[model samples]
Target chain A: MALTLETRDLTIRFGGHVAVNGVSCTFKPGELTAIVGPNGAGKTTYFNLISGQLRPTAGTIFFDGADITQLSAPLRTRAGLGRAFQLTNLFPNLSVEENVRLAVQAANGTHYDMLRPWMVRRDLIARADEILDRVALGNRRQVTATALSHGDQRKLEVALMIALEPKVFMFDEPTAGMSIDEVPVVLNLIAQLKQDASKIILLVEHKMDVVRSLADRIIVLHNGQLVADGKPAEVIASPIVQEAYLGVAPGRSAA
Target chain B: MMILSGDPPRSRVLSILLVVIILALAATPFLFPGAKAMNVAAQICIFAALVASYDLLLGYTGSVSFAHTMFYGIGSYAIAIALYSMGPVWAAVATGIAVGLPLAALLALAIGLFSLRVAAIFFAMVTLAVASAFQVLASQLSWLTGGEDGRSFQLPELLRPGTVLISKSLIGFELNGRVLTYYLVLIAAATMILCLLRVVNSPFGRVLQAIRENRFRAEALGFRTVFHLTYANCIAALVAAGAGMLNALWLRYAGPDTSLSFTIMLDILLMVVIGGMGTIYGAIIGASIFILAQNYLQALMGAASKAAADAGLPLLPGLLHPDRWLLWLGLLFIASVYFFPTGVVGRLRGAGSAKH
Candidate 1:
């Protein structure tokens, strides 16, 4: 498999506390990988470091065989890496199409074009509409992003990231705050996104069912260290995973 | 296909609105009946441009620096000094912009980097303090600034006719006259408005708006927010300096009392708030109200003063004094705050937009 993004000896520390330890991993192109851990397992910290939101104390990241460890978030994003926040970060006041249009603008490097009206540009608007439709948000295009239901907002967030046409995508708790019924909808979208063999996707999830359902491979993290890495079934069946999840030895039953 | 083809959507509407307004303004002097009406229209144009410059920083970027009047003062003083030295009007105007822009940029950089660390009310206070300090310095520097009494600058020639004919000379074409000054102001104001509109729609403007919405996100996106903000401030200063130069030439004088004064800040803030803080035309609406209200109130006061003297009665300052106009202005502010939180133009725009 082709490596889209690779971290080498990555470590992130906050003064006396370590959030992400020296654990290296690579996200292969055309694959969706899940990083699962209990709360405070530094999963999001690792995501932030990889996404250029946080500077790792000791680590180097490579994207598409080029070093991008020191690049800024926007630069990284422009270089074909897109991210979705655990907390929704959509532009609240703008209409759904407008939010997607900003992303499309950013990707097109036309943030400076002042003479022509954005709407008059049929090409960009069509692309924005295409991405919105892909995320099942074509119907909500005219509505302000703030007016969207929580599930619909999540879909719009995905639409924004997709609008970037990134080679690699990072989703931090995409299913957080969603109802059980809403979970399947996002799961189906994620499943569809993962089918693109040219795309690399990283997800941070706490739901074992989601991890089992969608992730091709699983990376288990505990106390900022990679505890297990293998196929989903193999990693979940590992003794270390049992110890971390059940807080006991594999053969022992917890009271 | 990409999204948002050339630039942002609202900017398109703004450009169209700007063209229509500029045409109306240029035609005002001709449309109006008399020289006095033309002069009044010219004054309206000048204040509108000034208020628009203020909005560049306050409305778009969200950096409310109270020292905007300092730039206005700098431009006034620059014109005053140049005109005193018998400088050309073009030279005075250029010098005013050159002097004002760098000073305002430096001030903006310092204020943005330092006070931004403790934003909102604290940032406002810091700006107010700097403005007050500049006001004091202006008063103390009697030699250069002409302290409280003000310094008069003589007008240079408005027109250079080979020989003066008896009949065909209008006041503006006949050399040193207020009509010529008014026309000059009208031209300057329109040009400034156009330039400012262009700058506000540029890529720099988008970055500034992004910074205003979310500083952390903008910073994370690798935008040096402070630098962008300072550049905006400098542009604002340059525009304000143009307005100031035109104003000084109109009045033919500059005074320390005129520069960095708190009352000037109050006027600009009121104009911006009344127009709509973030919208471009908000400033135009705000400035019109400000200039009109002041003129109307002063006229009313002048009539009361004449009435009191004619009746041979002790004149009450409340009815006749120009200072009492502030009471009415204060009431306008109170009413604006209570009724039209979005500003007069903004409120109207909002209502009009709601129809869609």
Candidate 2:
């Protein structure tokens, strides 16, 4: 099996503070990997490094054997790396289908035909609707993106990412603002996506239950350095991981 | 998949209405025998075209550029010089677009590169300064542009192919007279409107709309937005230059008043706003209102002056003078901004469920 995402000794410094320091990891295709830590643990910063949104102060990122540390965010996306933001970013004014169609259009390279009727293209619209259906948003296709519920907007954002048919998917706090009922739907969607053999899923999450339920492997960081990496149960059961979570358990920090 | 595709039912009606209006306008010289009325109508068509050109940038792309008149003047200068010194009217027309488009394109690229650092009023100011600088240059270079007086060119004949019979007519209208000028203007406006509609609906146009909504996200999506925006701006300038050349021919002279005037800019702006900022039909609707108001106000002011003397009342104030159409224009803008901020189309859309 080949690795979809591999970062070697990645270090990122913002001014005087080092946000991510000397972290090395390989995320394999078909694996659902979760990076979890307490607040200010730099999980998002690490994700940004791998997605090419941020340049590392040192080290390299190899995406499918190509060094992509210097590649732009969009080029990374074109190389089948997709990212979902902590805050939803979508065309708020356009219809939901129109938003999805834009992603489909991006992937298909139909960005210059002047006379072709965009919506009238049967196969493209079918593809768009299929993606929307994956996110359970088929009935709300015609509605403006701004009119949807909070949960639905999250789903729409995921649908947009899926429309790109990305090989590597990264989600940042996907369930941050969702209610209990909405959380399970998003959780299950990520789980379903992970089952595909060609897809690699990377998640930065905080909810303990969600991390254990979906992460095939778990990595923990403290103060921008990796502290633990293993199966979910092993990492969670580690004494250092327990100390990092419970805050200053006797003899752990001293050890 | 939702089977609904194509223009919604209302847009279909709008398309038909636009065709009928263009046809009626093409036939108007016969309906109204006065050359002066036809001349005014021809001028309106030119301004309407200018507004539509501006709409490509200001409306569709959401870039409110203030240097559009620079391209307008550039076109006028190119055509006037070409006609006087270099070539025939057709040659002059081509030169006008060629010179105007590349100049505007270069300027657009520069502005896009620099102006990304600032938006809204800062961008407007930068564009305004460029236009104002060009205005100053035009005034200083009296040898080429005739300064404030500007240059004059002979009106070029517009001909229909396959006939040199001089008085030959097309669809009952002569092709070699002033009436021919009107038809030419009509044809140009119709062609431009069709082309613009197609452009806005095309994939290229969708990218522009995406940039308008969110530039950062568009850039993140791998689109080189500055290049696309500059291209759009250049094309718009090319069309506006075409209109400018038509205006110079119709007027038989290109003056600072004709080319670089703030009044013309305001007229184009009003046309876009009153018609509906982002819609194609908005240009035509705004042009009609602008032309009608100017014509009607002047006539009404003349009648009022005569009537006032007859009734022995004081003369009308200069503020109310018909020549100062800007007063009414300012008021119209304020009202539009306050009441129907999206222009008349928004209200029309509101009459329905206000749903997208």
Candidate 3:
């Protein structure tokens, strides 16, 4: 199925607090949408909901015109909803290459082959090494995942996501904890991925510069509500986005 | 390397230790030459395989299942009941295995598929409850399982202990059915341990370790963690049952204390930790050392106590008393944990890496 993701009134509540309140949005193929929001604005929560990590209190998600709200996290991932965590979840003790190799093995469906030698999976190894090279982690292939620098770990996270080859790539704070020099490597990677015409990329990033440079469209979220959605310039220029996202007090006019 | 699925012990010291232990175990009947020695050798083989199987769950998969001994007990009890009711025949042992392996697999699947949906801790608790409940069920079901006294049955005619394989040999000991049984155990254990080595180094094992390290990442990579974990659980349970069958055959009996005891479970845990959590080689080293300690530590302590008392060393005599062996054992476990946090294998591997 071709990639088309839509959330119809996605809502989640923790007791009395509505973390993601009735967030209805549509994401199209061949476009990158940056979800911009302040702290605790449910941007990550929205991603979590779409990625099947959290169940919605009252909503439904559709992927390729099929209702997929009830699918589990793994089922959702298999259905091409690839997710990279905000906290950089990784196999800490495994070598860098082994970490990516696991993802490749998972994709190849050979992870269940109990008798096949893990190291002899040359196809998977080649693919994993290719990904490592792309992330500039080829030299550190033998290093354990936990020993990688923060930026390298982030790249490895992207490497893992790439290995899955999902239709809708969801990166939650992909550049968090990255140094300034390492930022372009990832941003460039994202730009290159944007060349694909059949994929939908959703990025949750706090940096407005990255949003301006890469986002084809921007969605502004405020206190669990989708306040503005449009081309990057129009949405960022809006008063509501400035007030809710830029931490400007709503009662006072934008000085 | 191919037999190990390309995963070696990775440390020269570890490799040498494993080779030495395996060689010593292989030659136990000829070199040791006593009933007690044969029993100890058989125990080392059985427990090595059993502990390796447990390591599949606890180490490779990062699962803590207390129900391991239940699967073991199932194997022992199945053999015991089959031989007692159907008569001591090869087919009875086959019947027992045919029944026990799949039964353990199914039970593991049921437990894993159901409880793994929750969390690792929940799975641990569920296994604990299931194991204890199974122990009770075995105790109550006297007709089939033989209850508290358990079931004592005969070995096959060829393994009847009195049957002599060799009347006289230069090798100092009579090669009888007992020796043959020890060899059978050694062969079976070696095969099982090697197979376990293969399993842990396979792509399946890679996924298991990945799941152990980070289940969420494994899932996001499109691997169904429940399926992988359940498969691992089933495999571990089968190996454990195989070990139990060997143990029952060697003892020519089956009992709760022998197979289903919680102490055995604790002992298995201790061996895994003392040996190394993630290495199958750790299982061989851990089980041999622990069983040897269990058997001879008291005697060693008795001698030490006598020397201390003769020297008038005050508290040293009381501390070194044979009955205080458990305290010394506890101290030994704590010291091992402190010194070798990753168990002996991990420590050796660290040394090998440092030299590089």
The per-residue C-alpha lDDT of model 2 at residue B116 equals: 42
Cα TM-score per model = 0.82, 0.87, 0.95
- Point to the candidate with the largest lDDT: 3
TM-score for candidate 1, please give it: 0.82
Residue range A1-255, candidate 1, lDDT tens digits: 365799988999999899989989988987889998888889989988887889989989999899998987767887788888787877676678877876676677765554444455567778889888877788889898899999888887777777777888888888898878877767887898888899998999988788888899999888898889999888887889888964668976433
The 10-residue segment with the lowest total lDDT in model 1 chain B: B1-10
DockQ, all models: 0.29, 0.50, 0.75
- Residue B181 of model 2, lDDT score: 62
Candidate 1 error regions (>4 Å):
A1-4, A57-70, A114-122, A179-185, A195-198, A246-255, B1-40, B89-151, B159-177, B198-207, B217-228, B301-324
What TM-score does chain A of each model score against the native chain A? Answer: 0.93, 0.92, 0.96
How many residue pairs in model 3 have overlapping backbones? 0
Against the hidden true structure, what lDDT does model 3 obtain? 0.91
| Residue A150 displacement (Å), model 1 | 1.1
lDDT of 2 by residue, B1-109 (tens): 1211243314444446455656667767777767667876887788778888899888888888887787788777877766766544677767766776576667766
Task: Give the alpha-carbon lDDT of every model.
Answer: 0.74, 0.76, 0.91
Report the candidate with higher lDDT, 1 versus 3.
Answer: 3
Tell me which of candidates 2 and 3 scores higher on TM-score: 3
Which ten residues in a row are the worst by lDDT in model 3 chain A? A246-255
Please say which candidate is ahead in DockQ: 2 or 3: 3
